[model samples]
Target: MGRILAIDYGTKRTGIAVTDELQIIASGLATVPTAELMDFLKDYTQKEKVERIVVGEPKRHSNEASESEKYIQVFLKALEKQLPDIPVERVDERFTSKMAFQTMIDSGLKKKQRRNKALIDEISATIILQSYLSRG
Candidate 1:
């Protein structure tokens, strides 16, 4: 079986995560510049068999799409065009950022490491993937 991948999209950068071939565990893969996302995915998919993609759907507590969804929608259109067969799923990403921060603190990361936005993005992607996995 192929892996399940997750993307946490941002305006400037995107965080990526992937499950193992067994689809048993989720792990942060990378933080790539938003402009390079398609290239990176194209290259990676050439090497790894991705069965599906899960994108973090940013939403406010009031159930409105966040401002970032504009960029995500554009990306999703490109993704659908590029990876036609692969299904794309969305998961609510309401508290992922806060949860990632708390996870960093709970894991005892140093202040400097905790301040890294890229790390936070990566963790947030992992969180998004984990939430999806938990549904099963």
Candidate 2:
């Protein structure tokens, strides 16, 4: 069976997470530059046999689409076109960043490690994927 993948898309960087082949465990995969996300996904999917993609949907306090939604939408379209066989869904990403930070502290990461934005992004992606699995 193929694994499910999740993406926490950002303007400058994107965090990636993937589930185990049985789709039981979600783990952070990588933090790549946004400009290189498509290439990264292509290469990753070729090797990982991803069945679906869960992208974080940026939302505001009022439950409206956040500004980042524009970029995500564009990327989503291209992703769909490039990989029409794999389905994609967007899950609410309201407080994943804050949660990621708290998770770092909870994990006993040192101050310097917690300060790594790339690490936070990766953790956030894992959180996003976990949220989708729990909800589904």
- Candidate 1, residue 26: how far the Cα is off, in Å: 0.5
- As for model 1, its CA RMSD to the true structure in angstroms is 0.7
Off by over 4 Å in 2: none
What TM-score does each of the candidates earn? 0.98, 0.97
Encode model 2's per-residue lDDT on 26-127: one tens digit a residue: 999999999999999999888879989999998999999999999999999999998899999999999999999999999899999999999989999999
Worst 10 residues of 1 by lDDT: 37-46
lDDT of 1 by residue, 4-121 (tens): 9999999998999999999999999999999999999988888999999999999988999999999899999999998888899999999999999999999999999999999999
Q: After superposition, how far is residue 33 of candidate 1 from its true place, in Å?
A: 0.5
Q: Give the range of the ten consecutive residues with the poorest summed lDDT in model 2.
A: 42-51
Tell me how far the alpha carbon of residue 89 in candidate 1 is from the true structure, in angstroms, after superposition. 0.4
